[model samples]
Structure formats: C-alpha cells, structure tokens
Target: FLTAPTMDDKIKREILPAAVNYYQKRRLVHRLNPQPVTEIAYYTAGGGCLTSSEAVLRPKAEIQRLRETFADGSELYLNFSDKPWVIGGRQIEPLGFYASGPGFEAETGRKDGLWFDWYGDADGCFLNARNYDWLMEPKGTAAMGRGPEGAEPQFANRGDAVVKRGPLATDTAVAVMREADGSRRIRFFPQKQMGFVSIDLAASGFEPAEVVALDAEGNPVAGSLDGVERGSGTLTIRHRDPRVWSFRLTPGKGRTGR
Candidate 1:
C-alpha cells in the first residue's frame, strides 16, 4: 500500500547506482542494479549478536567479551556497556536502550580475559526490554587480526600472539567480501602506513590458517609467493595489495600450505 509520494521518496533514497559504466559487453546498459541488502535481516535474526541455541553464557572466569563466532571463523560482537571499545581504532556506538523484566537480572561476566562474550539463544531472539518500534542496522565487521576475537584475521604471529596490528606485515586483505547472504560486506581501513611491513602471527592473535590469493579480476593466482610460510614472529611481506590481490582465509589446522 505504498502511496505515490511514499514510492517516490523511496526511489529517491534507495536508488544508489551500483555502477556508472554505461557500456557493458556492448548493450549500452541503462538501469543499474541496487545493492543486495536486506535492511531488516539483523532484526529478524534476533538482533544483538546471535549464538546457537545450545550456547550458554560463558563462565565469568572464561571469556570477557560478548561475541558470536561462527564455525567458519567469522565472528560478531556487541557492546551494551558504557566503557568505550574500538576495533581498528574506531570507536563504535553501543546498542540501543536496554531494560529487563522483573526476574531478569542483568548478569554480567567475562571469560579468562582472552576474548569472547557468550550468551544462550533464548527461544528466539532475546526480546529483552529493548524498543521494538525502532530497529538497528549493525555495520562494520571486526577488522581481521587487529588482535581480538574478530574476523578478517586468520593467522598473524604463528606461535606468538598479536594484540594490535603492527607495521611490518600486510593485513589479511579481503578485496571483494561477499556476505553469507550474497551481499557485499563492508570493511574498514586503519590509518595509512609508510615503509617496510613485518608481521608476527602469534603476536597479532592469528591462528594457523590456509591462505589463497586472488588477482585483480578475481582470479586465483595459481603459483605465487611460494616462499611465504606461516608467521612465527619473523614473517615479512611487502605491505600492500599485489596489484589488487585478495587473500582468502580458511581454517587450516597445522603449518602445511605455502
């Protein structure tokens, strides 16, 4: 039941041209595609960082942050506290107002001080005392290996451990990140760096992970950088994209791949 005026307003607000290129394969493309974004998905998926039904609020002595890590290594985080926290030096806003029911005690706990805040999946999305009239669209995935239980970072210092990104090694770059729902995933960049780059996997909080390289046009480079091995605090590589290269990270158990 969209009125003409409402429809017009939506068209004005939503129609962001995906690409400006008019000539594509020669047909003189006119209409551009809208980005594949389901605005209400997060709300429908139960709002604040969801976890499996079996997941429980971790012991106070175990994890210290509220995080939901997927089996694929992707992780999500949420903060309701006033204490400020930053992923890649960028401070994030806390979720909207919160209140609980009569018996609902706002129990708080932190795990072994490593990283991770766990909670049980209450029947459906926890319908805590949050304003339902307004929905929030969470943005920005954790920048890989800025040294937290965040994604985009697979393996940093192989044996040591990295808490923040250092200058020496190039970040685990994600060129065209496609979300699980097939939409484009957004990424954040840290301040510009100049000169040599060095990375120690363990120091940066990356586990042993498998890496694949993709070239500019999204084609995997068959055999390149064979000398690169898992970082054991001394690994070094040119700190920049190799002519628009994207690295794909997968769960690699041991020190195997090149």
Candidate 2:
C-alpha cells in the first residue's frame, strides 16, 4: 500500500508557493495600473485563495464557474508593506514589516499545529490578533519575537471567551472576556512588582459597566475600572505576585448577574 500526501507536503510543494507566485504576478500588474492594492491574502487547503481578480473579472453568471477550494486551517499574511491594505472591504494597517530572504516556508497539518519557517528581519512583526474577526499566532511563540517583552499567543473562543494580550501588555498579564455577556476579565501572573497593566477590551465587544474583581476561588476582590470609552474599556490589574484574578462588568446600571 502507498501512503497519501499530507496537507503540509501539499502546501509547501504547491499551495503556499502557488499563492506567493499568484500574488507576485498580480502585484506586478497593480504596480503598472497603480490601483489600490489588496493587502490581505486568504488561503484554504480545499479552496486555494478566495480573493482573486480572475473571479472578479468574470461575469456574475460565470463567477460560480470559478474553482473553489477549502483547507483544514487558514493562514493570512499581513503587513508585508508599510502601506494601507484592505481585506473584506475594510482598510487595515500592516501588522508587521519584514524584508524578503530565502528559506521562507509555511506548513500546516502538523499534529502540533502550523509551522512557519522563514529567514528575514521581522523587527516590527509583532501584531495584535484581536483587531480582526479571526486571527491567531503560532502557539508557544510570542506576539513579538522571542524576547523579554514578548507575550503568549491567544486562541479564539476558549471557554466561551476570547482573551487577547494588550498592545503593550506582556505575557504576565492577560485580557479575558466573554463577548456574549459584555463583560471584561483580567488576570495577572507577574514575575516582579508592577504598577498596572491596561488592557483594551474594545475588540471583544466590551461595554462600560460596574466592574468587579474576583480571586482564584471566584471571591470578590478590591479593584477599580477606569478609562471607559465607546466600544472600549481599560481595566487596571495591579499586582506583585503570581496570582489569578478576574473582572466582570455589568452592561448597564441595575442590570446584574452575567
């Protein structure tokens, strides 16, 4: 019997490289026409790349004739350039900037998860995944490169909530939230004494509310809520020990019990 080719093999040998070449050619044409370049690239194993000009150029009736593909996992490479780019019709800035080099490879379908190996200068490669509907970094890696200032990556929809590290927040602190209930949760596991860590709760559909803190055992703790703004709230979790904490925000006054 013969073993079938894996998704990683298909991606390395065909999918990703094909995408790079397709975009490179499309970019070349856009350079001459000088139209706004689409910054986002979507890839799936079954449906190679969903956003393609070829489909757009076809007639409405013939558009469905275009091939469709899907993948077990999806990967989007953002912030290749320092210009504004649009994805799904929304303008977004590049998450990071890196120079081109050799040995650039990305493979998925691994039991551990996706693997991206590349040789380049990723000085500004750090990004906040919460800005988008679906974005995640490789596990066991920092938002920035491996450094003292790096943060632990966050996964989507964990425990009915999505947690995101603040832009300047380190791995020691985290922003936990459950969007459906419109509440905010913060926890601290600091290495040394720190003043406070401000977490952005806008992306998780957070709203201003009567904030309360809870200890590891779910008991109320003393804390405060500040810097409340439209579609955003900043919670200051101050600590000096490696303890777990959480905050809950009631959506409106006299409305209790989340």
Tens digit per residue, CA lDDT, model 2, 118-181: 1111110111212121212333234324333224433221212222222223222233434354
CA displacement after TM-score superposition, residue 251 of candidate 1 (Å): 2.1
Cα lDDT over the full model 1: 0.26
The digit string of per-residue lDDT tens for model 1 on 109-200 reads 22122111111111101101110111112112232113333333221122222122221222222112322422221111211111122434
Worst 10 residues of 1 by lDDT: 17-26
Runs of candidate 1 exceeding 4 Å displacement: 1-197, 225-227, 231-235, 239-244, 254-258
For all predictions, the C-alpha RMSD in Å is 17.9, 17.0
Collision count for each candidate, in order: 30, 7
- Cα lDDT for residue 197, model 2? 49
